[model samples]
Target: MYFILFLVCAALTIIGSLFRLNNLKEIKQPQGNFIGQISLDFEEIIVRTSVKEQIKIRDIKNIDINIRSIKGQYDGYSTSKFYYENGLSNGTENFIIMVLNNGIIKKYQFEYIPEISFLLNQKLIEHYYKIGIMDYLNCVDILGLDKREDWEKFKKLRT
Candidate 1:
């Protein structure tokens, strides 16, 4: 009897928690113009990425309004992210905040760029070195095990 009671209580508790978490936005809604429109209460804060339909929230806060900008995307991987935590209020004038891709946020300074370029040159250098070694073994004074050596070296370098 005790086990059955405990199981019921646990199930109720889990359901209650899920309900509260899933309804966080619903719980916080402004009255007046927002009446009957619970879904639109949460405004989308979007950051533009070159890849269409992919966006990171960057940060979220409960406020009277959300001011969003369409900063167009950049090249490379869009990494280095941070959030401006709980800093905006609709009634207040300090809603502006800056976002830097290096995980830094400046107050009200906003800009967007494609993801930064990686060290492609370094990768190309490594590739050239491997090709040079393979060519040397293939065309120059070849060693008895040059082919095997080249294969092993190239495979290891790939990793």
Candidate 2:
């Protein structure tokens, strides 16, 4: 009975590892406003939207991940405005990617998937180093506390 249980556990471990390895290759969102997929392979990163787009790994200038929150309130009238803030709140988490392509900056927004984001970021950083691009990865927090005093207060509160 002990030997049989050990065999079962070993098989489960192999299956779990295989699943994780396959998941690292591609991430897909089949239904949403951004109904597409992002895949990483040897040569390039492919983004499939209504139209398919391919970006060669070597041509990539920089990959930036932006995290921000936007809150909207109605003034008891016909006007509703979204206020962008610098820190996380009870609102939804937004993930924004700013990519520089052919001298133009293109922005893409998607719902945050923490695991997929972290994996993709790690893969990109690895590839960037292989291709001799050192400073290509960046993370930006878009909550608008640009003032030095405000940033200091925010840091203190967080600690």
Candidate 3:
């Protein structure tokens, strides 16, 4: 009975080791976003989903937003942003990309991933505040958010 128990424990240990190895392999080599992959690295962040949706951006780009009309779909404007890497496409089919200094936030809609959106928004608010109004507005201007209230709200959110 002791021998049988020892064999069972050994088998379990081997199985556990195999499982750990599989997990490590996954971490080392990401399989892409179609399987819903979200990777954050030191220099870049990538978000992808199966439905031909993806967003990849470098850390240096900082926060940016773009508003444009969706073709034959919405009566309102849709945001077009983000720089895709590795041949990934940020098609206008409900995919939105928002890039920032530390990372990028891309999704079908801000409501789709509230947690990620909140985190990115917080980061943008902090970054804008840290750089002061003139510089921040310069960024906002580039993104076409020229309204004074938009800038004011951004500053207010810092508190």
Candidate 4:
């Protein structure tokens, strides 16, 4: 029937639209001021902002790095405040590094820089190994980190 064919076409169009919207990559634009910096030492991950805070490698619960769009709604108002105060526009991708230590979540947001993001991810992985993968996996759940491949490999090796 024509009605059935029309309904199928309409469903396909809606699905296609949703797929395209989900897959659309956010554009990278110059962002606001850099708020914090992260560096790794022998036993600590030092975060320097207005004040320096050091978190021991053994105390870290989770480390996550992701590209976040400024346009999206954020639970942390500080992120939005910094973005708008620095005169940044919507659709700017921010390189967000979140570290969970002792039940506190510290977020450091910076302008989208691929090299910096890559280095941070590498440093976290390096530090995770120092504490032993088993211990790290115990502290960090499979869903806690964005890098699921590493989690899968470790879980496989453990089994």
Candidate 5:
């Protein structure tokens, strides 16, 4: 029947069109921003203005920013700040300052803000940064720090 033949042709045409569109989409590559200073890559953030009903969802409402600068050995402090978003998450902003040292990261303060009010555990930060090194290491443990890497055979990067 001519009608059956036409229907078959129509179905095949629709399927072929969808297949072509999908193939084109697959060929497209995703894009993202590269943080040159640090080894971080993130996708471009876009805002969609949708006036939908507000639901009680728990999520990170603040953004934490930290900066550290050191001049010499055994010196330097870190400053941090917290900021809030007024509108939908959109666009990207970044600021960077020189960090002299990042010896130990004990507690990553979520929504951290640099201020007199910003509270941090001084003792915990100090211990996490240095105490672990001495507490659990012998001469064999620090061999990798050696310039010659005397234990190259012993420690093969674990990777």
Candidate 6:
């Protein structure tokens, strides 16, 4: 029965090693440059990229923000030519960005890079929201641009 005992120990060791490796994958180090910035004023949300690509979403009442997690070689690349020139390594780094006017009803996608994945997660957790759910609410919380009551009314609309 020594062979059976050895097999059980071997299987456990292999499973433990895999669990450790999975944890390592989740451990992210912010590599490359801080290539993006997001700001909010009373009137609008401003997103600025390291390459000088800027987008301003006007009329806070109508705008919505969405966050997406991008990972792997098969995932798409940034449409902006600036990202290519800046030498952003693809697939190695996985992170989320805020997409203004995201989804089918909206024709255009304006994704804002947050420089680090943790920053985006921290912002969402701090605001008590999840991805794909009331993105505008998260935006409102992160930016601190509007009153809680105003956002609450919007949140209740179920649009």
TM-score of each: 0.20, 0.40, 0.26, 0.42, 0.18, 0.31
Better of 3 and 6 by TM-score: 6
Q: Candidates sorted by lDDT, descending order? A: 4, 2, 6, 3, 1, 5
- What C-alpha RMSD separates each model from the true structure? 20.6, 19.0, 18.0, 11.1, 20.2, 12.4
Task: Write down the TM-score for model 1.
Answer: 0.20
Per-residue error (Å), model 6, residue 90: 17
Model 4 segments beyond 4 Å from truth?
1-28, 68-101, 116-126, 129-159
Between candidates 3 and 5, the lDDT winner? 3
Model 3, stretches more than 4 Å misplaced?
1-63, 67-73, 76-120, 123-125, 128-159
Q: How accurate is candidate 4 locally (lDDT)?
A: 0.52
Candidate 4 lDDT over 1-159, as tens digits, reads 999999998998787665544433333234466667767555677878899988876776656544454342232322331222222234345443444555777666544433343344544454565455225553244124557786665545434
lDDT of 1 by residue, 19-84 (tens): 544443231222223111111111233333342321133332211212232223221112212221
Q: Which residue pairs show collisions in model 2?
A: 85-143, 86-143, 86-144
- Give me the candidate number with maximum TM-score: 4
Clashing pairs in 1: 74-114, 74-115, 75-114, 75-115, 97-108, 98-108
Whichever of 4 and 6 has more TM-score, that candidate is 4
Residue-level lDDT of model 5, residues 1-159, one tens digit each, is 999999998998787655544443221221353322221112111222242222111221222223231111121111111111121111122222211124222222121122321123333222322322211123222222354454453233322
lDDT, residue 71, candidate 6: 35
TM-score of 2: 0.40
Greater lDDT among 1 and 5 belongs to 1
User: Which lDDT values do the candidates have, in the order given?
Assistant: 0.31, 0.48, 0.41, 0.52, 0.27, 0.42
Backbone clashes in model 3, listed as residue pairs: 62-100
Q: What lDDT does candidate 1 reach at residue 51?
A: 29
Candidate 6 lDDT, tens digit per residue, 1-159?
999999998998787656544443342323566655555433334556644434433322233444342332122333232222212323234322434453323222323344643335544332323323335555565444477786775455443
